[model samples]
Target chain A: MRVELDVPKCVASGQCVMAAPDVFDQRDDDGVAILLEERPGEELLDDVREAVAVCPAAAIRLVEG
Target chain B: MSDALACPVTGASGPLPEYPLPRAAECPLAPAPAAQELRSEKPITRVRIWNGSTPWLVTRHADQRALLPDPRVSDDDLDPGFPYVNAHRAAIAPVSPRLITNTDAPEHTRLRRTVNGPFVVKRIEKMREPVQKIVDDLIDEMLAGPNPVDLLTAFALPVPSLVIAQLLGVPYEDHDFFQRSSSLVLDGSVPADEARRVSGELAAYLDNLIIQKTADPDDDVLSEMAGRVQAGEMTHTEAVHMGVAMLIAGHETTATMISLGTLALLQHPDQLALLRETDDPKVVANAVDEVLRYLSIVQTGVRRVAKDDIEIGDVVIRKGDGIIFDLHAANWDPEVFPGAQRLDIARPARIHQAFGYGPHQCLGQNLARLELQVVYGTLYRRVPTLRLAAAIEDLEFDHTGTTYGVHGLPVAW
Candidate 1:
């Protein structure tokens, strides 16, 4: 699973960081989501999916490539 | 009073109950008992409101999630059928410019897009250090002065005004004027003409600021908006109104959360102790969301007008009908949240609709969250012995406003 985040569009509500901490960490300065592991194994998919669902700005997108 | 206020139930008593039902004076924190009763008896029940309109009052979480985002929902307040919060809102709807608050999708999408850049997580997060400084400085001043002070005035109100002033490149000193005007506009108890006068003053204030920014652009939201006006991307009036919306929206709600959230924490000592002990930003952040959910401060609920016929559960809402989603009922819903009434800080409260839901969800929410995270994470720890100076009953609560909050929260260490 390839996870992509549109940094510019991200409103940084921190849902992604809260939902999938290992997969997402907010940049300390701007608090925009920084993908920790863009391609994650199956174990983290549930959280990754939840992050995308909760992001207020619709900034996170998961690509199944 | 005709049969309009009568409950449709086959054998019931009293009026159908007012839409903005009075919260029990004793149970200041809980939603109106009538609202809670309606949530259980009929999740989608009709309730008469200020202007004698009977909008469907939705009370369940699942019901709100199903209905708020439905394409059939319309937020255009100008529509004669819109469920306005009060006469003041209804009176202005016809003259009010198209705004993020009143416009529905497509147009809402377009309008929201123009100003969405400034509030995105990245931009708001950048302000964290600055907001931290603001909170810390305020705490120092509060500590140095009187033992018992109204947190509402000293800490809660100013933090947002300063932050928003910084964001807008407006002077923080002028907050008193805008704050008064915004309060008058949002206060349902105020007469319509008075609210209109205040609204005009606010517009004129923003208009003058927009003009200033046009000549000497700064690294701020208003300056960015002025640039848009110059590029013909947005009109002068649109820019001015957006400035007013962001200022008013950001100020009162965040102020309310800080003051009232602290009050809630103080009431729940165990929860307060837990939050105070936790140094983890994650824990603190989650606790903020939980407080927002528990309070569900936007008491009037997210108002909308059904643009097309829609069916959810057993109820069918006809086109042009007004809908009011009672956020408190939905947030405390038992089906999604077990032991919902209990203020469990550890609960996963992120998806709560305190910010409302769907596209029109609060545009300034990210900023509000960060400000709260800083204040909540800091205040309790800084003043370990902090306690409310007055009994909960003694505190004056603003029941007639858009958000349910305390007029003042007197506290001492």
Candidate 2:
């Protein structure tokens, strides 16, 4: 699974990064959301979707492989 | 006309107009001349205004603070002839039982205690790292862009919305709806019919979410409230009202403060540069307080009705009369803050009515402080090159609304 983020929409509320830090990271400067992993192993799919589901701005998405 | 009625701003006053007075464009802070006039005399004074009848205006720093949590000051608008309630009736309908602002004493204390644990100083301190991460991520995007980003929409609105949404356990996808509904509710331009329609829809949405949480609880605030409601600690209706109130108050006020604070920083380049150079958290915390005090975006406080005959300063407020504590005026009073008009981050012993005083002081103040400390600290350090896209004078402040804010802060690095 690939994690995608609409950077503009990401408010950096840190929900995504909190839920799945391995897949999502916050930029140190402005608190925008950034995806750390383009594609993750099948085992992490649940975590990625959880991150998307938890995003307050709906800025995160999971692109399933 | 007595010389005592001199205006606070111009130091010229006679018998001033009444409560719920029409908006004065030049001085939006105090609606009545007596309010401004009272400010000049003492740290706090009272003004009697006759909107249709008579109402008392609390104009001093200490007095406003004293009255906020006073039992004699009721928050109930159900009273038949209260001026402020009747005046704004077209604007706000009592959708839910009055939340924290309107309630008093034991009930207010009880309701406030339920979620107080989450917002305590220590718990909020624990959120610093997470809040910092959020701030850093947002700044990263602003830098990624070319130039001239609309900070209000891109930065200010989303930051608080995301933070509060996470706290409430609401999904991010739902924020767009939350933001829209909240804006509509706050926006005075939205006609009564449309505002009510939007509010009803939003309430329905929240009701559904409450039902979902009731069935399958999680480790979120909403879930916690659901459990409390089920256990008879809180009513189902209280849970629903609280959920909506938390969502709106938690986000809107902070968002406006952030945006307005940014505008202040940009206008004062020296202060902006000072923030850029400082890495100390103490300095940043002080800066946050100063910004909150200076901007006071919550503007006028939630209205409180006089439960009994109460004397505030020199004014005797009769029973059933409504009073609006002018937060902006109190925060800006020169008595408490020597250089109250200036935004000095280093001002010592700074106490302002920004978060309010007494028992009803903002429950979310700790959360707001943490979010601000992170945002201001990170923004300056990362974007030292940041500057406004437009001149400060050219920017429009949201003067007409109950909440004061800049419509949009166009900026670039």
Candidate 3:
């Protein structure tokens, strides 16, 4: 599985960070979600899905590699 | 004989109790006994509220998570069937500007985007040091003055009031005026007309501030909003009303949390000790969410109406019908929380609905959380011997306001 974060669409609810912190971290200035890893390993798939599910702004998307 | 089939009738035994049921005197920290019971029995049932309107009162955690985000569900208060918290809210609904609080979907998305920059997790997290400084200074002043200090006035109230003022570029010296006006507007016991007048004053004050920010823009949220007005991104009226909303929503809720949360901690010395002794931000953060869940200070619940017929579980909310999410009950739900009655700071409680859920969750929640974390981390540790001056039973709880809290908490160390 491949994951991509739409940083511009992010509202900084931080649900993604809470769900998959290793793959996403918020910028300090505006709190927009920024990608920490473009392609996290398979071990992080469940959490990435959870992060996508919980983002209030629907800012995260997954792409199957 | 199933309650689902029961006629939509008004009666005590009609599956749903009257809305805003009285909290049991013996159970100060739990949801209203009726709400707690209903959470187990009929998670979603119609209940009568003030002004003789009936709305579906959702009590379970999972149900709230499911329906709050449904497209059919809405936050627009202008709907005739929308469950207003009180007559005052109903009175203001029509005249209330189209705001992030009142609009749904595309409009809320737009307004929320304009103001979302300041409240995101990372932005609010930067406030820790300054918020801690404010808490430390307030503690210093409180200690220097009186033994039995009113924590509501001294510490709990000032922290958010000051922080918000700083954020919005309001002079902290005039905190008395805006603070009092905001409180009056939220106080349900106050007459609707009086509340309206106070609300008007708050809006007018913010209007002038927005104008000031327009010409003399500063490094603050209000200034950013003023810039939006200049860019034609939002109307001037909308900006002022948004400021009023932030002040009103941010003020008492955090104040109540501090006083009531401290009150809860004092009742359980072990929990209070755990909070005080720990230097871990994670522990303090969890404690804040636990207290927010355990108390669920926004006692009236998140009010909404259905735009179209929506079905979930065993019920369907018809088009134009009302829905009230019983936040306190959902937070205390036994299914989501084992031993829900016990106050455990160690619980992984980040999922609680104290901030509500979905798109309209809370605009100021991250800011509230940071202010709370700083106070909770600083207060008990600073004044290690702090204790309540009066017994819990003797304190007067303010049930007349939007947030359930004590009128004043007198504490001594």
Best by DockQ: 3
User: What is the DockQ score of candidate 3, to 2 decimals?
Assistant: 0.39
Model 2's CAPRI class is incorrect
How well does each candidate superpose onto the true structure, as a TM-score? Answer: 0.85, 0.74, 0.88
lDDT of 1 at B104: 70
Model 3: per-residue Cα lDDT over B48-88, one tens digit each: 88888789999899898888877688988988889899988
B311 in model 2: Cα distance from truth in Å? 4.6
Model 1, C-alpha of B173: deviation from truth (Å): 7.5
| Every model's TM-score on chain B | 0.90, 0.83, 0.90
The TM-score obtained by chain A of candidate 3 when compared with the true chain A:
0.90
* Candidate 2 lDDT, B1-413, residue by residue in tens: 11112223543344544443333444332333444455666433333443455455566776775676466767666564344533455246455365556566566555555655456444456778867776777778777875888887777877876676667677768977876776776556689999889988877877777779989887567777778888888787787777777767777678887887887777667777878789898788789988887776654445666878887556677888767676666766777777665677888423566766545667677688889988998877787777789976567777545567777888887
Best by TM-score: 3
Candidate 1 docking quality: incorrect, acceptable, medium or high = incorrect
Rank list by TM-score: 3, 1, 2
Q: Model 2: DockQ against the native?
A: 0.01
- Which candidate, 1 or 2, has the higher TM-score? 1
Return the number of clashes found in candidate 2. Answer: 25
lDDT accuracy of residue B312 in candidate 2: 58
Clashing pairs in 3: none
Native RMSD of candidate 1 (Å)? 5.9
